[model samples]
Target: MSKGEETKTRILQQAAELFNQQGYAGASISDIMRVTGLQKGGIYNHFQSKDELAIQAFDYAIASISKHYRIAIRSKRHAIERLQALIAVFGSFAENPPIAGGCPLLNTAVESDDAHPALRERSQQAMNSWLNLIRRVIQTGIEKAEVQNNINPDEVATIIVATLEGAMMMSQLYNDTVYMQRAVNHLNHYIENNLKINGTS
Candidate 1:
């Protein structure tokens, strides 16, 4: 990458961490400058405004998490395994978060609910992609006769994602990983006993 491109990328990385750790309202230009070692003019040279930087930073954060998800699920042939792989990624958030603040999707969604329309839309799109991924996995399993035919992919996907997200919030709130562990355990059990065609293990 060229020097300019490299600098822009670095700024995005620093800004993303700041915005995720502190919401759009809480994160200020000074904070970004502090983290990135870039002056206001330097930052504006790349991004037109703080609003623009925030949206791009959010995209960068989402890409980071999506990259982890893609790597985790890519090699698993079985639908259950793929879903489990995704869950394991979430389970790692407590100790090895992809982004420093937490789940970017959750953080942005909550903070941008009414305050920022642009971020709200971006978070919504990201969440839709996640739900669709889960839905596709369940559908594929059903087509292969690997999962129960009666299972509702949409409903199950919501339950799984919501459960994991909620568990993540609890883990962060209480500073205890047991909350996340319990959620992961329950999800695994639900998949085996309820969704799978046969309980293999």
Candidate 2:
């Protein structure tokens, strides 16, 4: 990468963490500068405004998490295994999050609801992407006859994603991992008993 590209990436990386820990409104330009060791002019040369930088930073964070998911679920041939991999990686957030604070998508969704329309839209898109990933896995399972035909992919996907996100939020708030573990465990049971074909492994 060129010097400019490298600097921009550093700024985005620092900005992403700062924004995740302190919402877009709470994280000021000075804070970003502090984290990145960049001056105001240097940051502005790369980003038009804080809002623009925020949108890019949010995308950067999402991309990191998405890349991890892609790699984690890549080799799983079975539908249940793919879904389980999804759960496992998400649960891993408690111990090894891609970002500093927690789930960037969840945090931005709540903080940017009425604060920043662009960020909120980005959050919505990230959620849709996640939902689609889950649905695709479930759909593939049905096609392979590994999952029950009667199962609704959309409903099941929503439940799994929602449950996991909720578990993460609660775990963060309570400063405990039990909530996430319980959610993950219950999700495992649900996938095995409800989604998987009775005789299939």
- Top lDDT: which candidate number? 2
Q: Which stretches of candidate 1 lie over 4 Å from their true place?
A: 199-201
lDDT for every model?
0.91, 0.94
lDDT of 1 by residue, 48-116 (tens): 999999999999998998898899988998888988999999899877888898888999999999789
Residue pairs in collision within model 2: none
The digit string of per-residue lDDT tens for model 2 on 135-173 reads 999999999999999999999988998999999999899
Model 2, which residues run further than 4 Å from truth?
A: none
Q: Which ten residues in a row have the lowest lDDT in candidate 2?
A: 192-201
In model 1, what lDDT does residue 166 have?
97
* Prediction 2 TM-score vs. true: 0.98
Lowest summed lDDT across 10 adjacent residues in model 1 is found at 192-201
Count of steric clashes across candidates, in order:
0, 0
